[model samples]
Target chain A: GQQVMQIPQYQHVQEGEDFTTYCNSSTTLSNIQWYKQRPGGHPVFLIQLVKSGEVKKQKRLTFQFGEAKKNSSLHITATQTTDVGTYFCAGYTGKLIFGQGTTLQVKP
Target chain B: EAGVTQSPTHLIKTRGQQVTLRCSPISGHTSVYWYQQALGLGLQFLLWYDEGEERNRGNFPPRFSGRQFPNYSSELNVNALELEDSALYLCASSDGTSDVKNIQYFGAGTRLSVL
Candidate 1:
């Protein structure tokens, strides 16, 4: 069985602070995906990484996949109120095992 | 194009009762997935249906079951519901292909409250 774990179950940051969440797996993953869910909203797809040591960026957010493919990370820069949500990392088999999610609260 | 759509949006039921949640996938999608998110918890995989067949399921009890329609739509049935069954159940759809890297588009989710 594959399981994904994430750190910093909860975080609060100033408007301009940087935030990062890490995802680790009990077994190697073929790929890893990230998602965000606002309070009272459904989870939405973010970005994904498949290749070892792969890195991708979306404006202020950066995502990376570990060389071993057993870990990943999501980084946000200059956080804003809109960034207030729970960030989840899902490790997949034929199906995905979602992390417990990291709740981010931003203070302006 | 429409995203995944789920019915009722909210459901309220009492213990020992039964409830069914519906999900309609985006057009042309062939795979449907069900997940339950307890308050302040992660999305726990419930089941995965593709091409009108049950391909896989999570570590849930037999009381939780579902089926996929010929059109790839799905219905999740929960029997003998208990207070612990209270959670936001989300439905997602994907092409079930590697091209999308198994990316899943989720619906607004049906918030189920078991009294």
Candidate 2:
């Protein structure tokens, strides 16, 4: 059985500050997927990292996969109030195993 | 294209009762997955259906079961429910043909309340 663990279960940051969440897997992952879930909304796919030491960016958000492929991270720069949500990292092997998720709250 | 769709946005049932949740995958998707999200808990894998066959399941009781339709749609059935079964059930679909690299799209999910 594989387990994905996320750090900083909850975070409250002032707007314009940077926020980062880390995810680690107990087993080697074939790929890692990131998702965002707004309050009371379903999870939405954000990005997928497959190659080791891969780094991808979307707007102000940056995602990175560790060289071991067992860890991943999502960083948000200059967070806004609209950036409030829970970020989840899921490791994929035979199936997807989601982490506990990190809840981010940005203050105005 | 339309995303995954689920039915009965919310459901209320009692312990010892049975409940069924439905999901319609995006057009052309061939794999469906079910997950349970309890309050303050991570998503727990429930079942995975591909090509109308049960491909994988998590460490849940037999009371939690489901089936996949030929049309690629899926239904989750929970029997002999308990108060702990109160949680949100989410359904996701992906292109099964890809095998290793499937990015799942999820539905809004069905909130189940068991009293």
Task: List lDDT for all candidates, in order.
Answer: 0.92, 0.93
Q: Candidate 2: lDDT over CA atoms? A: 0.93
For model 2, how does the per-residue alpha-carbon lDDT over A1-108 read when each residue is reduced to its tens digit? Answer: 688999989999999999999999999888999999998888999999999999999999999999999999999999999889999999898778889999999999
User: Residue A30 CA error for candidate 1 (Å)?
Assistant: 1.5
Residue B96 miss distance in model 2 (angstroms): 2.2
Q: How high is the DockQ of candidate 2?
A: 0.64
TM-score of 1: 0.96
Candidate fnat values, all: 0.59, 0.62
Point to the candidate with the largest TM-score.
Answer: 1
TM-score of 2: 0.96
Model 2 iRMSD vs. native? 2.0
Docking quality of model 1: it rates as medium
lDDT for each residue of candidate 1 in B41-109, tens digit (9 for 90 to 100): 988899999999999999999999999999999999999999999999999998765633488999999
Candidate 1 global CA lDDT score: 0.92
